[model samples]
Target: MSRAGLAAERTALAWRRTAVASMITGALFLNHAVINGWRPALIAPIGAAVAMAALAGLSYLRNRSLREGRHSRGGWVVATASATVVAVAVLAFVIEFTDPLP
Candidate 1:
């Protein structure tokens, strides 16, 4: 692969790493929700996990397009994914630290 392709691969790998970390956060949130005996609290983390999976899939597709000499607005995708991950994390924290029933 060319150096440019390698760079793209590296960036994609970084995104994947971030996604994996977010998955861990999701797991923790889900676990905490279960411990707290609140079934609804699982929603936020579950959604985050689903989003992470989608993001990962997009990253793979973006990489494939890159290898195929197709233009991909990966920067936008990465930025959006990162923001989503951050939002999910914030939501999880809010749900975790606040009382939902009272």
Candidate 2:
């Protein structure tokens, strides 16, 4: 394969790793929510998990595009992923600092 092909392969692999990481993070968030019980206060963790799942889905889409050689205008995808991460981080912060409902 050519250099460009190898680079694309590497990028695809990176995306796959990112997807896996996102899934793991989502699982952790879900686990935290479960461990904390079925209180309304656990919604933040649940939302974080959903965001992580969306991130993983986005990563999968990007990876598929790379594999199919349709590498056009990925800026939106990256932007969305960034926003998701920021949102998840905020949710996590809220979850960590807030007192559990009585």
As a TM-score, model 2 comes out at: 0.89
User: For residues 8-69, what per-residue lDDT tens digits would candidate 1 score against the true structure?
Assistant: 66765675676566566656655666666756646666676677667666656665665566
Q: How many times do residue backbones clash in model 1?
A: 0
Backbone clash count for every predicted candidate, in the order shown: 0, 0
- Prediction 1 global C-alpha lDDT: 0.66
C-alpha lDDT of candidate 2 relative to the true structure: 0.86
Candidate 2 stretches greater than 4 Å from native: 99-102
